[model samples]
Target: MVSIRSVHGSAQLLLDVTGGVTDIVEKMHRTIAREVNPLNRLRDMTGETPVAKQGHTYRIIQSTTSLLKQGLHRSLDGLSAQEEWELSPQSLKITAALNGVCGDHLEASGNPLAISMHLRNSRGEKLQPGSTSLSTMIPDASPRIAVLVHGLCLSHEYWKGHNEGNLGTELQSAHGFTPLYLNYNTGRHISRNGRELSQQLQRLIETWPVEVEELTLIGHSMGGLVIRSACWYAGELDLPWTSRLKNAVYLGSPHHGAALAKAGHLLTSVMRQFRYASPFALVRHTSAGIKDLRHGNLLDDDWAGVDQDDFHPDYRKPVPLHEGTRHYFIAAAIGKQVWDLPSTMLGDLLVRLDSARGQHSDDLKKLSICAEDCRVFEKLNHLDLLDNKVVHEQILGWLA
Candidate 1:
């Protein structure tokens, strides 16, 4: 049976999309008619085109909007929150994808699907991890916490693959470390999410049923940047949780910056140079979180007042790893041979080898991971890091 909640949610999304499209079209039409269309401008100057006709177009748009609201409201009139069904994996995936693309906007606009930072159980239910709620949530939770942060456009559920096992589960069975999955909005600025994560970790550790002896963070891609950002904030605030942090592992993380986002920004810039293509360039108006990844931004000041569509030189401050924490990095490449430049350049498809390894031309921006602590795997893409057997073994070895 189709869910009323889904129906209502779909209708609301449709209305929002329609409204945005309508506004864009109206603006484009006005611009083209006034400036691009010489014939219309000539007609206006010659008094051949009636101003009233243009006014009619706006009136029709207003009337259509009113009708759309009425129809959507009527369709959702009998729907109640109780009628909502549990979110399927597919539905959750779609929601996560949307959040990754426009999460900052959705959050600013107060969209219902905008995900908040939460610790989730294996079944994907949120756990408070507070003293009062920890027992009811996870009765046998271990004091050694291993937190897993997923990449952009993904949810905690993504950690559980189809056939191959994820690192978190494997580590749980091999070692007695308890795994906590984080579900958060990936569209917000990395620093914003980082600060929130820092605070949340403090709360989580302090409220643990037992003393947190060790806290290890395993982050993939952008999740690594968030972890790093959180670490900086944790130091600034002098949180007690910082003392408990033991190991920090980054898998396929673009510690320097991803080339793909830079290339996309170039394309958007080219499109914005012309009048007609300018509106199309709006397609690149992704969330601030994604834009930050372009230069591996780990601080709020990195993006202060920067235009979303324009390319800016790297303005990030150097964020080194915590001195007390052990850092491990793993990068993947699709090339069969490790020496292949093509595959090496396309590190894990989304990150570059040098970037993932935290190499930088700017001396200040270079990270402190030792050469021995880093590993690179050939014949693997970015997502493969989650389930690859060899990668799993390497992680187990590192944790051990």
Candidate 2:
């Protein structure tokens, strides 16, 4: 067993390693594309160069950068069990920088990033209140509908994977459940939002002015945890709506928590000084995201509550443990086959098979997966759980 301190240390190492190789990864973006105006701009600012002449310099910079990034990602990807998930602030900064650079260049070239961010957040998007639609709020009967919650760092659009997209839309269309896309800043405190979500679910159940038949939930990654937290609160409330939990499925939930998240907290604590220099300090620490991430894992101070004007309703304390045995049904996906473990765990890139499962207690009463048996998706990764067709088809078929 690794100590939390060691977990932090491993994450710090991961960050340091990733940070050192960031420029290279960014270079990969510059390369493989025909554009080279940035190189001309850099040269003209410092010296003088024709736009045509800038291609060579751009290629050189991009070449060197790509090699470094490829090497780095491979190394990070190759980390062993004890260190696989660790991330440092340095790594995150590198990742953030990579994200910014990629997003900026892509936009300049008239291409937006993938994943359409249609929904606002857990708070819901702006809609005129008076007029109602079927998707907005079901009418005339019990509003007991299907609500869809997305995973961490993702949007409600995650569920609408049609043609290699998420299945949010399909759930509404095919499953006959009112799909409510739950989106939030996953970097925030899990339990706090859990309560807020619980309140939201309670309101969702009560407000529709109709009888809710079954409140089915499907969560991926951190979304799974949030759903569980909400359900735990609802069950405790003993409300009829709470009893409507008919089917719940988790794609790749880390029921025992991810080693990587905890490791990331450690990385920031170590490099907070050197990296947090100057005005980058505020944006780096707060707007950039470490503040909330650290707080979520109970590592850094609570930034959302203290700094970001966080708001969450209070409820009974969560079990803080996965005890899905009480649910009407539960299902989870495991991508890796036993023969491929250590080298490849058929996980959704981020979540592991063991952690995605329930406690090893030899009792079905304590089963983490609510299913009498689970469907193991042999070759899917974490992202594939949402994007892959086979996985979605299996889910739809099973539910049907």
TM-score of each: 0.90, 0.52
| CA-lDDT, candidates in order | 0.82, 0.48
TM-score quality measure for candidate 1: 0.90
CA error at residue 302 for candidate 1, angstroms: 1.1
lDDT tens digits, residue span 1-400, model 1: 6667656655666666767676666656656777755677667665566433664676687678768767765666466344645678888788888888888977885445677788876657788856586767777778888999998999888788655886777878999888889989999999999999999999999888778899999999999999999999998888878899999999999988887887888888898887777776764777888888889999988888777678678878888888899999999888988679867667778998989999899888988778889999999898888878898899889889
Task: Point out the worst 10-residue segment of candidate 2 by lDDT.
Answer: 109-118
The number of the candidate with the highest TM-score is 1
lDDT of 2: 0.48
lDDT of candidate 2 over 210-246, digit per residue (tens): 5677777777776676777766656555544566676
Candidate 1 at 310: error in angstroms?
0.6
Clash count of each predicted structure: 0, 26
Best by lDDT: 1
After superposition of all CA atoms, the RMSD between model 2 and the true structure is 16.9
TM-score of 2: 0.52
